[model samples]
Target: MTAPPATPTVAVRLVPGPGAERVRVLAERAGLRCGGDEIGPAATVTVIVAADADQALRAQRTRGPLLFVCDTVSPEGRRRALRAGAVVVGAAELTEAGLLEAVLRAAHPHPSIPYPELSGVLSTGTRPGGPPAACTPALTARQTQVLRLMAEGHANADIALLLGCSEHTVKNVIYELMTRLQARNRAHAVAHAVRHGLV
Candidate 1:
């Protein structure tokens, strides 16, 4: 695997309490920009501070790969994290090196995190060259906005904020776009959009 094209900017969302300070200090010490609560449009990775499984799960609605520093994570939480493309790092095991490594792996997804249903059917490159617009799917303006924001690495909540709509609207738009693209999930939808230049 290759490293991310650029040094990723990490968004750290803290669970309010004594441990919050510790996370702040650790992130700063590790040279990670503490992009507080609000997820940035350009955020390449995310770190969510959680005291336990529930908190970790609730704090992880953001997009892209994420690292969860939690005291304890349940099996269900692990499954959800896997499906969401996130890693759960036990708080006790957290370290400067570990944090940095998580950030690195987040940028370049590790093979251990399986790409479900991809089946080696995927290819890379953002250059538009699928089918002509006339032969491809047509996207609504809202769908286009959601797809573009998702492509630029914004979460649903961030997309809602950027487009001045509710998260429900964003989800509906994504569902609609995914249906149109015949995609299995958000990543697949974005990939299909890029491949077909439907965005």
Candidate 2:
């Protein structure tokens, strides 16, 4: 007789709040075997939600795969999470489908990355079998901010409002990111930033 498929375990480390309830609902909807605050040894993925992502990352350090959910994450935070062995870092706005995908990728991570799977999270527009592209210089602080907002699907007007800048400035940042990254458009620029973990 064939053996039954193993159930995947997901440990959700969220405080007792609105976000915790939402995460629980979503994880159940995704058909994941959801657990509580601590990521058990049998846990395939750890979903951590914290206002301070670094704190969550630190706590989840030495785990297998981790997905961090936060309102905002700086580039430094991204590096810190990666260094601490997180597989994917995401915004609080990630859809249920997106969260499920993150969990799946964490279960079967990329071999080259060795840390966590980020290709799906970042979505760099590279053709299969081709070398991954690199950002020639580095993105400025403002550009990083704008690109991060873009990743969240914010429009120029909304980005302007959030950044306390003019629409023109937002447009300029998008244009510059596209040009610098050789991206086809704003979405591509955001994808590049995501793939590179710059945002």
Candidate 3:
């Protein structure tokens, strides 16, 4: 008789906190075998739940596929993760199934966004309109301003202050822009804008 396929083991290297406990439960629910803090050869993917990107970078010393989860990361933090070849998934978008998929994706290794809102980033390069335009969609005047500020690596709060709007408004604008451009995050949106010469 043929043997059943082996379930891949993921290393949950989260700091001691409620987040760590939650990840453990999620891993079990996903039917993924999870290992302890020590990430060695046995681990197919190392899942790190960090409070911020700095913590994620610190945990990235382990040599293997890594899935980094954090609340939010700065532009520099994103660059560091990209340089380290670690996949970053926002904590808000992470789930049991998502975690499992992320682990599998880490094994394959590709630049893709895990969030549903920006999932099209890697697949579609054209604007939302019917025909493929010479350039990406033309950003509205407000979006242009926001994109410029974002390209400058300004945080949401700082952008809001500069634009005379609330932080929430800045965040909403960014979300909309990401959805329109299929951008993974703030840094990605800025990159897309720059690539398409919109910024």
Candidate 4:
């Protein structure tokens, strides 16, 4: 007698490029049905396309999450995408796997400690007990090091190289960190760490 869990919704706006079909295919594989073709807003993820810098900027101003799939990765393109409020940007040549990963990440941002949650914890500070059990345990020294680099937006491959570990190890650490923090995803977890002064 429990209600079914809501499926995450993703909106995909086709940017001017040859890869629109490819992007759509990737999204479908991720269990995200097309927006207009399926549902409406009030959905968790909205995928929008910005064909050019101008459109991208406008999309950003609207304060909606965007996916900037461009034909090139020029500095100007990157700047425009970021300015357009894209949390992730990709190129036409980007592999389906890469684009899908970026989209998934954008769709599921990490969970955060809301003011009410923090307030409740702090107000009950130290009580008769030594200290309230840490809601998020301090990351191990190594995990802390990895998280700092992650916060700087380094990819797993780059982080692995920097830490002299395998990319798999970096991924594992990231997974563990997210699990411990109950983060919805990596970006959210990083934001949470930063907000909590954990990293």
48 Cα displacement, candidate 1 (Å): 1.6
| Residue-wise C-alpha lDDT for candidate 4, range 117-185, written one tens digit per residue | 233323332222121247546777778778767666678999999999999998999889888877777
After TM-score superposition, the amount by which residue 10's alpha carbon in candidate 3 deviates from its true location, in angstroms, is: 6.0
Give one digit per residue, the lDDT tens place, for model 1 in 92-148. Answer: 877766666666666554423324212121222233234567877899988877877
Q: In model 2, which residue pairs have backbone atoms overlapping below 3 Å?
A: 122-194, 122-195
- TM-scores of the candidates are 0.46, 0.46, 0.48, 0.42
Task: TM-score for candidate 2, please give it.
Answer: 0.46
Regions of candidate 1 where Cα sits further than 4 Å from its true position: 1-18, 37-39, 109-199
Instruction: List model 2 lDDT by residue over 1-199, tens digit each.
Output: 2222235544444434436567767777766667654456555676777665576655564456677776676545654555444544456667667677666655654312322233334443332221234534478899888876776667899999999999999999888878877887765565455545555
Which prediction has the highest lDDT against the true structure? 3
- Which candidate would rank higher by TM-score, 1 or 4? 1
Model 4 alpha-carbon miss at residue 152, Å: 5.3
Candidate 4 regions with alpha-carbon error over 4 angstroms: 1-19, 49-55, 58-63, 109-199
**RMSD of candidate 4 to true structure, Å:** 14.1
